[model samples]
Target chain A: MLKMTFARKVIAAAACAAALIAPAQAEEKTYRLKLAETWPTNFGTFSEPAREMAKLAEEMSNGRLQITIDTANKHKSPLGVFDMVRAGQYDLGHSASYYWKGKVPNTLYFTTMPFGMTAVEQYGWFYYGGGMELMQKVYEPLGLISVPGGNTGVQMGGWFRKEINSVEDLQGLKMRIPGFAGEVLAKLGASPTNIPPGELYTSLERGTIDALEWIGPAMDLRMGFHKIAPYYYTGWHEPATELQFLINKRTMDKLPEDLQKILLTAMKVSAYDMTINSHHVSAENWVTMTDEYPNIQVKSFPPEVMGAIKQANDELLEEAAAADPLAKEILTSQADYLKQIRVWTDIADRAYLNSMAE
Target chain B: MLKMTFARKVIAAAACAAALIAPAQAEEKTYRLKLAETWPTNFGTFSEPAREMAKLAEEMSNGRLQITIDTANKHKSPLGVFDMVRAGQYDLGHSASYYWKGKVPNTLYFTTMPFGMTAVEQYGWFYYGGGMELMQKVYEPLGLISVPGGNTGVQMGGWFRKEINSVEDLQGLKMRIPGFAGEVLAKLGASPTNIPPGELYTSLERGTIDALEWIGPAMDLRMGFHKIAPYYYTGWHEPATELQFLINKRTMDKLPEDLQKILLTAMKVSAYDMTINSHHVSAENWVTMTDEYPNIQVKSFPPEVMGAIKQANDELLEEAAAADPLAKEILTSQADYLKQIRVWTDIADRAYLNSMAE
Candidate 1:
């Protein structure tokens, strides 16, 4: 029995030795991905989390895969993130899918679809309810692999230069909005401009733009948006704004199976991190901004404006479904998911929120 | 005069040429850090973001700073995160600060204070209201530096084996809760056990633990906890649970000044990612668990239970503050910040939530 045990121990040591030495024989492939983002390095929204994902991927793969992300303008132009990734100039890109409405009409479904669903509902549809599969279908045609990167739970309407009294106030007003919302704003007789993060400060400061909307207070304060625009409007039109990571298909396909898995897993981690950080930073930013920038008047949108936005959202969603097959599928799926969720949400989630408020 | 003008042009050309050539000589020094985290690699909450930060740090620094994160149980136990980082066993540790209440009473402030602040309020106190300074003061003496890593915004009570009708029901109940709340539970006659994430499943499944309170629906659903308990409760006790990253001061000091800045920037991003992910995931998890787990029943605690929790929280805070001067300072600072925020939250946040609920 002692001799048998000694042989087993010897075999165990041999197995451990093989495990330790196996990795050295394997070839390490380092994939440096330039992720062009519309956020500064210090922006604690999705950009921060994207960075974290890259770090995790490298570690998890035992340094077999390396991804380096250019946070802002370090590589490609910030506003050009989508185009850059689509064209394979960048290995990865982080931005709102809605920002590229002209390129892919169905992209808006991944980011936001007017009053489509809440943050929770969106995640369900995307992950479990075939939302991710459809999203990949759309992105595959664009030469990219997309992942849900981050989300700002529910956003404020946006920062405004003046108080909006009615629907008429939105007419001809220059607003900084991206994605399908811009189309809706344009439909409402407003002019929309796609501005990158850094340029926002200069654009608002020089009166080049009348009104703008970023994530929310936490990020807005950092860029000193409140200093230039005293009237900050709530972002009711966008309750939950999602950010996405677009990886170059060619670059991603080159990675080994394990490395590819690491990147996907890392991206998932970043998605959650972005949400939590945005909430935390926004909360802190609101407090600090109020204390420091006392002149900044934060106000909710007037009932008329909110009513108009809601009405426009419904119309826009219907119009997109009617126009494109992919948009129709994604929107229909998202809507169906939302319909089911609303039943429970209305009864449980909403009820609880109401109960707690009192 | 013509010759002089030519000379000026030549000088300008030379200067422009110098500026163009400077890029070649601007190679940054790359510093690699090995970080240890208590979260599993599959746990997108911390591991994913931590990895992303490292990747972003390298990119933002143009390869000047690189970080590699070791996930939970990869190198050390999750419970050992604080001490491992403190003792310089690892460069950084990403986990909840509340896990180390026995060693540092004030560490809970970095995590969350029961009934004290929402996620936003906590961020406000930490970043702007000298809360970070206080944290540094508390951690520096222990050879560590801390930052807000992530937050679970207003969590669900937990999965209960049976409904909790009154305070009497909680007595002698074996519950799994972390941080100071666990201590409060102990004080209230319940048995509180600090179990790591990996072990939470079997303990709750085998009847070793009567209840377990994790972040919320998002995470709980993923862990499949609802399947066993079937009685989900709202976590009014932990409104906002904060996760923290503890960096070894020695390791941090070794980095170049710019690398240190990059590290801080990445941390802020990681925190944002974690918070947002929690919210988004929680939203979806709620829908899945309710739809799939038919036997699972989601309910809220009675007002009397909530009142008891609030009362217990107040007493715990008072006693803690009385015991530690630093804890008193942080609590006081948080109170001041919350007082200022309450005015707006009560009207804006609560009012909006109330109006939105059906």
Candidate 2:
């Protein structure tokens, strides 16, 4: 009887140990996160970073971190990603920072500005310069963590029915441009208007708009704008248009240390990958566009017109800076960084390219 | 007595399950990897990718992955990284692909080629335009897996004691330039010689060589070459000098699926990060160089000189292609890719830069 009693006690002790360790192990439970992206389903490279991030995070965490992405089509709100993520409707969002400019005025600076740094130079500022801190200052107040999502190397100026020979050509020109760039065009006496994406083609085709600025060749080729526009102008505004990833601070804080690192690294790598992919797709599509439509003329606005556009951009920047102290600080930082970096760029890449041309 | 027996049976069953699970858990044992780098300790941006990759891999794997790095100083073989990694003396190596040209002539094409694509374009070629397949064809036969380690965006031609006015100026000019670029210069009647990095500065200072080609401002600033040399020439030799990460196929195959993904993601992200960081450092260092030494003149070789150099490079490439079927295949692919992509580059980035210059 005593032996039986001892066996019973031993079994109980073993049960207790199992109880202790099982839950500890179970603490490695799978975390399911919902991400919302601004781009609709199958929106080319714009939708890539979110999916790539989710896959990487899940793999790196051994299936512990599972992220499901909802495109704008499913969510029925293309521009609502910021609010959705902020209100806890989604844990994360992938969108352009400039998309939130209407809600948060300071958010505009995080994306490319008019005639801003190129992709490499802007990345330098974001990582090495004070761009990240400045970005954090703007986001932390809203309970958000923002990171570089992707970069469109250099956006094209626009597709034009008419070649812009001088500043006078822009006067009273009906163009479809949006956001701050549109505002800059407005300052130059051009009638810059925003149209729905679906309506853009019709507008350009029917002479409703004289010109339209869209994304570069990668995304634009599918839109079929190259079929209508004969003159493709080079970019001046929106030089390095960087998309952004936004995370709810609370959600990020809740993750385990390793999972958190996985998530962060995944986001970072996906962002960089998207940048490279964009360049690749653009090169591929550009070849296709030219091969099929051999008459598509590439043009850059003359120096006189470019100088006028620059002046307008500078004035608007000044006004924005004067209005807000943070804006001033951010603008000043970007300007100082650009001034210092451009010298090197001129000496290195620019000189090299020019030499090759010679 | 019946109740006690039932409880005992349950405990025994639980114990059996735990035993079954524990070995599966034990499979998550930590993996320690040693890596050898071609660069010495504290070798600036060149040493960053390996350390960054190791950190990311460990964090992502929840401490399952740990990597330690040894520089050339410790390994006593800067040029032996390839052999060491191949022999499993080190699990991994960080070096440039071109370093193995003498041993494996086919390894030369993985790094940047003269007059080839720029950084962004080359990355495009690697990921999307079939560069990766070509690289794998070379490395897989040797039981190695190689990935882009990092990039020095564009290397400046060299610092010169006198201006290179024409093709004639290169005649009898002794310069410290190695690899394929040296061969090109030698074809143009320049006496191109290889020297130890430690001895380069003294040689240039003491007139042992009239000029020397090193890395760009990011690395060159530390060497203080601008202090002695007056002319800083633009690059033609290496447009995008991509460093390489070599892994033993057996070592990689031994890793778990999730760990393998973590390792790959870590390497890829670290490589991209280094590219951005190099640009940042170069911009920072260039500022320092010019601020102190105001008289340092930036020049591009005359068109006549560049033309002669191009012809020599083309002939050497032709000979390389004639030597091996794989070499011919790679050269053709690169040429074809460059031809297609350069159009997009011209329309997008190059056009934008020129417009801004105007």
Model number with the top TM-score? 2
Clash count list over all predictions: 34, 0
- Tens-digit lDDT track of model 2 for B1-358: 2343344345544544664454222323578899999999999999999999999888777677889999999999999999999999999999999999999999999999889888888988998889999999999999999999989998999999999998999999999999999999999999999999999999999999999999999999999999999999988899999999999999999987778889988998899889888888988998899899999999999888898999999999999999899999999999999888877777777777777776
Model 2 chain A poorest ten-residue lDDT run: A1-10
Whole-model lDDT per candidate: 0.69, 0.88
- Most accurate candidate by DockQ: 2
Best by lDDT: 2
Question: Which runs of model 2 end up more than 4 angstroms from their true locations?
Answer: A1-16, A19-27, B1-27
**Fnat of candidate 1:** 0.01
lDDT per residue as tens, model 2, A1-358: 2343344345444444565444223323578899999998999999899999998887777677889999988999989999999998999999999999899999999999988898888988998898999999999999999999999888999899998998889999999999999999999899999999999999999999999999899899999999999999889998899999999999999987778889989999888888888888888899889889999998888888999999999999999999999999999999999988877777777777777766
Q: Which ten residues in a row have the lowest lDDT in candidate 1 chain A?
A: A20-29
